[model samples]
Target: MVSKELVLKAEIRKENGKKHSARLRLQGKIPAVVYGHKQEPQSIVLDLHDFTEGLHHGHKLFDIEIGSNKEKLLVKEVQYDHLGKKIIHADLIRVDLSEKVEVSVPLVFKGTPAGASEGGILEEHLDSIEIECAVTEIPESIDVSVKGLKIDESLHVRDIALPAGVKLVTDPELLVIACSKPIEVAPVEEAAGAEEPTSPEVITERKPKEGEEEESEKKE
Candidate 1:
């Protein structure tokens, strides 16, 4: 669940583009944007260390306080540097606490499947599922128990039990994961006569052409 007291302090940005963004990075800040329905997109900058620390604190839904106005937002996308070690930019989507919004949360599988204990392989289709819920009701992660799952058994999105004001947004019939036995491929067997070449037909005699027969008899 998102913490009710979680809030992020952000500052409006006056510059954009690569050059200006690089200068922001040197100042220990990162470029960020927030936009949503009926709201004008706002350009801003965040303290890199502070922003990352909030994520480490397990904040899935952020209560962003910009200027005198506070807005609830979800982390939509994150841009990383070439090395993927540094945060270059981020996109935040504003949300309404009273209105339901869709967001993908990580899928957490708990307990060992019965098939897995019996030597069957467990395969997962997706790591997350989309859910529609109020900002306050958003879960940190959805837990799906695979306990007693047998071979050939599967779990779907419809099986999840959502919170009281939350609903599943993904396809109900979508297969989340399955338990199956490992397949053993057999080797191909060659036929006994496969390596040998076939014999050609034996024609007893070749008939001469009519003109050739006449010319041969005349020459003779």
Candidate 2:
């Protein structure tokens, strides 16, 4: 799914430091930096709620407005709190709509596999794949149909069908998904009659001492 155009408002940040960033977060905002396109990096602040909501909706490309200036930017990274539940900071890079960019697109498996009805387990090896496409043509996620796969069947990166302008950047031989027969475990009852081998007992004779032997000979 390709994302719809997403627009956000940003403001230039004059101060830098952990304290200032913490203060911003307290106001429901996030510290961010924009760089790329041979331009100097710009420190900016974005609304935490709006940016988080956009991300939850799978937005990657954004049109951010700063005062009278507007630029297209792509999400580069998002830092979260130590608990990984809160957004801390974000990084965005400038992009041109006309240029091609490489990004990782999520995979969505569709339908139950045919192998599932046959007592086979369906395994997913990859959750996302790297792809190259026009910035404007970036997809939210790629759909992979698993209904056609039968027992012991598999799908590789090369088997996926992408949008017209999208190209796979991952290795063609990488395994994407597979359906395999479930492993069969032997029942414990079947081992009841099996006898475990026991080690044989060993015997050793002790030799009589020299003085004892001589005394015994005299008695004889």
Query: Model-by-model lDDT, in order?
Result: 0.84, 0.94
lDDT of 2 by residue, 7-124 (tens): 9999999999999999999999999999999999999999999999998898999999998999999998899999999999999999998999999899999999998999989889
lDDT of 1 by residue, 72-191 (tens): 788888888999888889999987767777887888899999998778888999889888887777777778999878999999889877767778888999998999988878997886
Model 2 TM-score relative to the real fold: 0.81
Full-model lDDT, candidate 2: 0.94
Per-candidate RMSD vs. true structure? Answer: 8.4, 7.4
* lDDT (Cα, 0-100) at 189 in candidate 2: 72
How many clashes show up per model? 0, 0
**Which parts of model 1 have CA positions greater than 4 angstroms off?**
2-5, 81-86, 183-220
- Positional deviation of residue 26's Cα in model 1 after best superposition, in angstroms: 4.2
TM-score of each: 0.74, 0.81
TM-score of 1: 0.74
RMSD of 2: 7.4
Range of the 10 consecutive residues with the lowest summed lDDT in candidate 1: 1-10
